[model samples]
Target chain A: MEKADHLSMKDEPEVQGEPTKTAVHLSTKDRPKVPGEPTKTGTSMVDTAAAAVQSFAPLNQIHQHLCAFHFYAYDMTRQVEAHHFCSHINEDMRQCLIYDGPDPNARLIGLEYMVTEKLFMTLPDDEKKLWHTHEWEVKGGFLFMPGVPEVMQRQDLEKVAKTYGKVFHFWQVELGHELPIGLPNLMMAVTRDGQLYPEMIKETEKQFGISIEKERESRAYMKGPEHGIHPLANGGGKGLKLELREVDIKPVESVPRVFV
Target chain B: MASSGDEDQVPPGDPVTVSTLVIDAGTKIMQRRLPVKQMNTHVSTFAIYGGDMSRQIETHHYIHRVNDEFLQCAVFASDHSDAPLIGIEYVISDRLYENLPQDEQKLWHSHAYEVKSGSWAYPRLPEVVASPELKNIAKTYGKFWCTWQIDRGDKLPMGAPELMMSPQGVGQGVLRPELVKRRDEKYNISTDELKQRRAEIAEPEWINPMADYWKQHGKCFVLDIVTVEMNRNEKFP
Candidate 1:
């Protein structure tokens, strides 16, 4: 909520010129570049920056934070690797991180939580099949179901860790521990349209015992993985100047309770 | 005011001899007499081109004929665009000038004809040929080709004849007496009907059928070169 407030303040006067917008672009591009860069013309510079940063890290990293903090998507591992890997590296970063096929387990993990019938139907076949099976009869016919328990399933956690990395990353300045101004609300607001409004964020936070905040007293520069938010330092590459502060927002708030 | 040693100084005749006269396409323009002063703003100037004398006379007479029929008809207003006048220049010997009709010859010196406005519309030439209106104009004037102005903001009517006419900036003209007479004789329509028909016929989609027909045959319709040259001279299509 505080983050959204700060962002509105920041964005209000930002429309005066292209400098702040350009800042976002340059910030995202603070990475090594790769060969055969796609041309950027007429496209908003912000998209280019986000794309550049996505290339620096694995899609699993982005996916992990996104799922942990917001809605869950099944079969995200293959999709992330296939569609997102090594796509946004600046030319210099391309020299450093070649798009070689490396073991993804070292950097990521996948989660396999129980989903509702509605949620199961919402997912594709490959994703829905990742759970257990059950059978029951409804009005017109007998229904065969992939039975997933209501509680935070063990296999789901394992899957999450396997696909997205074990340590999810968020950003903090060199020694500071608080979540930066807009990032936390930004994380809460990431599902689709814009940021979640203040009321929704509060309601969701109260319903889920999880805390996305980092402890002020902690001396560690990186937020510990147990905190469910990883902190990583970004920036410092050619053609990029400002350092980026990022946090991985994961999807842990909506696990169903298993009665068994 | 001749100097003391200027006994042999003779007045220079027309700069170029009529027999050897040569004027490139950009030098002359034809303007229909209208209250054009209303259109010019501080930045906007009517484009004027050097045109042949007789064509200029016809254009001017055409304006007078229209004004006499439809007193106070607002036709070519300059207020819509910022482009300056642009067209060609021609040097006609007195012999050619005398051959023109008495009424047209009288129009040569009246407000019915406006001299070149010294305005340049664009840096490059127009690529499209003479306008359909001009082709029809040529038909009325008994000539194969002549210049005409498309009213400001109005495009040329499609299916215009192949006549040597340069596309000028947007221009509109009141209905001339001959045109009104012809309309009454041919279709029994009024000036209002003509205006409505003109608007309906100038849609951009009107050219699609021609384009599609050409595409079906795996061939393309190319504009005439003379029209292209006229556009090049007028800096308009």
Candidate 2:
């Protein structure tokens, strides 16, 4: 099958091109009228994000790449109601993979993550077996950011572990020659009980030492009869295509001794 | 096939009867669009923003402030990439559009969009002011979070005050009986002429498109407001 033509335009990010020689600073006063022009925080940021996507793209394309490399693999079995698992799937963050095809022949069509008041429980024997598993066998595909770095003087990682019970790892994926700043290794955690995957920012702060300013969350919705297709295909095309809603959060300056 | 009222549903280009009475009403508008350092939605969808065609499109609730009769009127959905979405268009009374601050103009470009197809266009208005009852309806139910579609009993004319009063009008106007007399008697201005001036002063490019469903049903006019809680992301108060 010929791949969709529009796919290239959608997938090819502007950052993929060779770095522009001209620098573009975007201070509030000097910012251009253009709404979403790329920032000139130097090439490192661009190169890193591009590299992350490049690495992720291929790995994601091959479902068993990790398994072929000896990583333990499991097909997302049937989707029962949201249940708590000690692994990546949990009550607060229940996710199931929807395959476009029923078997290996089909690609992953969509992923649904749900968080609600209902909580899922786990069995003690199952928890023990999962805990004994080695690091080499476990592999996950996701985007991560470090919460605190390992070298930070405050030992923020320890604080995070104490505040939000933790069980996960962190890594900085190098994209070719460039060491991206914001696109550094992700700080992530997989729960023994599938729940809110606590972002591992504490480890990031340890390495980068309090560089990030804030945390924000956003929701995206596609308007259509075809569900996911662009609106224009449905006849009600508009210049503005995407709708994103956002949430604001204040950052913690330093970890408190205790939660009030 | 059901009620006599149901039999008179609207068909495109077909003249439909509108009763003076207000029928079913609802609102569907988004609140203000805050300025964020990162416009991720724009980037993800348009692959363009802050560029030459980088126009800011802020959404807000449509309010009616006439008597204590605030209400929601209609709901709109269109794909503007084809042409501007069309709800019954109305010209706002110049007096009302002019009252809006320039900063607001900079913020809420007031254009409508059809979700299915990505298109953008300016709405044409017949007049600025709605009836005192309509204004009251908007004010009472006009929340920053919702949009509304309405049906009054009358066919919307293609002109000003009459068009605004047409089931789908969203323009503001002077409801005081005395002001109406003064503007008309002293200035010899018909409601249409006043609306012409109103459109000039306000220069509003934004208008809501009534959903095609409402248009077909022969709604007198449509009003749309978007309520905040309706947003799926609104998990907390």
Candidate 3:
């Protein structure tokens, strides 16, 4: 089986055929001459000028190899609703989009993070306190990659279960508001059963039409020595003791903004 | 349907987005010959200090290769399409920052305040996407230098490479609102609101020791021809 290509050029070269001399004559007659500029003949000259302008068009460069994953996150401050569709940025760093629903017109509500254990371990002890491990999300079947085969999903989950993520929601879609309002609030995933409103997860499962019990059962293979939490994860570190709490840190709302 | 075990059965494009035709990772795509302007999401504006420390030049940075061991950012005068390229800031991981010699390390600045304070943000992206990028950026240290002082109205890059650094503390009045206002007007966010949000993020106790050394020393030395010439004249006179 051939592997799928990830980076194929979208543009194909244009084939040049015979150029008519009549077209060149007509173009020269129609073109307005600029003051003190030499009159140009030949379609080749015109084509070169057109090509020069075309070269200036914005070229889209593939900056990084990207892959997408889905996530289920709940607001840490509110702790009522679970948002869906969190995506990752380079497969290693998780960047999830918080949408209102599964529909195409779903409102983009917030963003979340999933970092590899390797990256998470390097964060300072203070920063680590802001992030949460995916153990409960994985073990409880609350988090699962959608659309992929069960085998592939299991493989992805094994990698995901070993990582940590931080979530922040700018739009609180759960309050029945039509638009995202207020400042961005830091969000958290349920690290334990009964921590979040159980009904919210059930509602999310119903909306997505997936059973958490079955998802959890399928991910049983991800358990064991390979998926154990990193020491630095869950706010645990050498010589530093910190407890994860649901405190609202409002001072972050004051960070100065600059237009980019 | 073909068995999932067959790798070829997995289609040629991304399963989610059908319009985007992709080559397999194994296929080598030609590097873009044309100068490509990719929109780097995590772009932040910095008031870089010069070698003399009195000169503060505003710079816009578009960060790339962020997930890699070394993060690279292209400095621009503005976020506009025609914004001139002024410089580059190369950030390395703490592991790499630690290995640099004392003299070399003095050039880099700690991102703890920049990240924690919300000074560094994804310019045009939604909050959901920008937050994690900022989180990832907080972990690294950057060494920035600007060749073009676009703020000073130099049509082209002139003079020696000026040392660049992020603001050390919040509300230090280091970041100019006039410059930040132009950026906020472009992005549709108030700089005051961002300043308010930044205050909530706790400052990290552990900062890059290199940044600490430079802070105490109160000067950044850049080897430049202009400085050498001036020093030579002083010695000769």
lDDT of 3: 0.44
For residue B38, what is the lDDT in candidate 1? 15
lDDT of 3 by residue, B1-237 (tens): 000112231111123222112321211142221112222333645654534333445456644342344544555555443344455566666666666666557667788766665556555555443444454456667766565555554432333345566766633225655555655666676656665665545555467666633455444455322111110101110
Candidate 2 chain B, run of 10 with poorest lDDT: B20-29
RMSD to truth, every model: 35.8, 25.7, 25.9
Question: Compared with the true structure, what per-residue lDDT tens digits does model 1 show for residues B1-237?
Answer: 000122321111123222211111111111111121111111111211112111111111101011101111111112112111111111122333334444323212111111111121111112011123211221121111111223221111111111212112112111123422332343233434333334322222111121111112222111121111110111110
Residue lDDT tens for model 3, A1-260 = 11121111122121121111110100111212111112124322332333333222111212211112222221122332333433222344533434343333333344455566666655665566546677667767876443334554555567667777765444334333322222233444545555444444554566556787887777776652244665544323211111112122123235344435
Q: Evaluated with lDDT, which candidate comes out highest?
A: 3
- The TM-score-based order of candidates, best leading, equals 3, 2, 1
Instruction: Supply the global lDDT for candidate 1.
Output: 0.18
Q: What's each prediction's clash count?
A: 72, 133, 30
Per-model TM values vs. the true structure: 0.15, 0.18, 0.38
* Top DockQ hit: 3
CA deviation > 4 Å runs, candidate 2 = A1-141, A146-260, B1-213, B216-237
lDDT of 2 by residue, A1-260 (tens): 22221122222233322222221111111111211113234322332333333222111111111000000001011111110111112112222222211222122111221122111111122111111111111112111112212133122111112111111110011111111111101011222222111122222223333332221111011111112211211011111111122112112222122222
What are the Cα lDDT values of the candidates?
A: 0.18, 0.18, 0.44
